[model samples]
Target: MTLQTQLVLRALLRNPAHEMYGRQLADETGLMPGTTHPILLRLEQAGWVTSRKEDIDPHAEGRPARRYYRLTATGAAQAGAALAKARRPRTTALRDLAGEGGTL
Candidate 1:
């Protein structure tokens, strides 16, 4: 996956049970809203994530309902595995250079 895609996945994976609005996710992932929301839409289209309109009284709150996103179990596992793989130590010559000890 692209690093940005992985970032979105990891952010959502952090709290699979918690629903987060696009703006909230953008903040948490340190990604621009443009970047974050598109990733979310892709995930939603793939059935890896789901979104809902917040169940609050917009008039009472004086604002529109926020759309909240959460990961599906399938997504959590898939993303968690990708994160784990990304975190694994490298065993290549590159690792001896830029990736590890030497400054390439």
Candidate 2:
């Protein structure tokens, strides 16, 4: 996965219950709205996130609706795995180096 997608997935996992709009995501990730929104749309297409229209101003008639996103169960699992893998140490490189010193 692209770093941008990974970052967005991680953010959703961190706040699974809270539905975040594109602008909120942009602010949190320090990414441009153009970049972040497309990633979110892709995630939604992949069934990783569910998006819905949110009415921010209940009293404002016909105000533009906001798109809110929440994580799916599959998404949660994927995000958890991604986060764990990101945190894991690079043991493969160390193992390869250790073999070179064996029986020396």
Candidate 3:
């Protein structure tokens, strides 16, 4: 995964049970909305995330309805495993390289 993708995933993982709007995630991850939205779209398409439109009335709220996203139970488990793998020690990765006859 790209660093931006990792950042987005990490942000969601922080509070898997709490839904966040795209703008919230963009702010939290320090990524631009252009970058964040596409990542969210990909994650949603991959079934790693689910989203719903906020129930508030836009007219009454004086703003557009926000689309909230949250990690699904299965998604949480999958993301956790992926993040763990991504965080594995560099030494372990080097060992794998050596085993594969790759130079340091």
What TM-score, computed on C-alpha atoms, does each candidate reach?
A: 0.77, 0.74, 0.82
User: Per lDDT, what order, best first?
Assistant: 3, 1, 2
> Cα RMSD (Å) per model?
3.4, 4.2, 3.4
Q: C-alpha displacement of 55 in model 1, angstroms?
A: 3.1
Compared with the true structure, what per-residue lDDT tens digits does model 1 show for residues 52-75? 988899999998999999999998
Order the candidate numbers by TM-score, best to worst. Answer: 3, 1, 2
Per-residue CA lDDT of model 2 for 16-95, tens digit only, reads 98898888888888889999999998888888899999757755766567889989989888778877887765877667
Measure candidate 2: CA RMSD: 4.2
| TM value for model 1 | 0.77
Candidate 3, lDDT over the whole model: 0.91
Clashes of each: 0, 0, 0
Clashing pairs in 1: none
Better of 2 and 3 by TM-score: 3
Q: In order, what lDDT does every prediction score?
A: 0.87, 0.83, 0.91
Top candidate on TM-score is: 3
Question: Which candidate wins on lDDT?
Answer: 3
lDDT of 3 at 28: 94
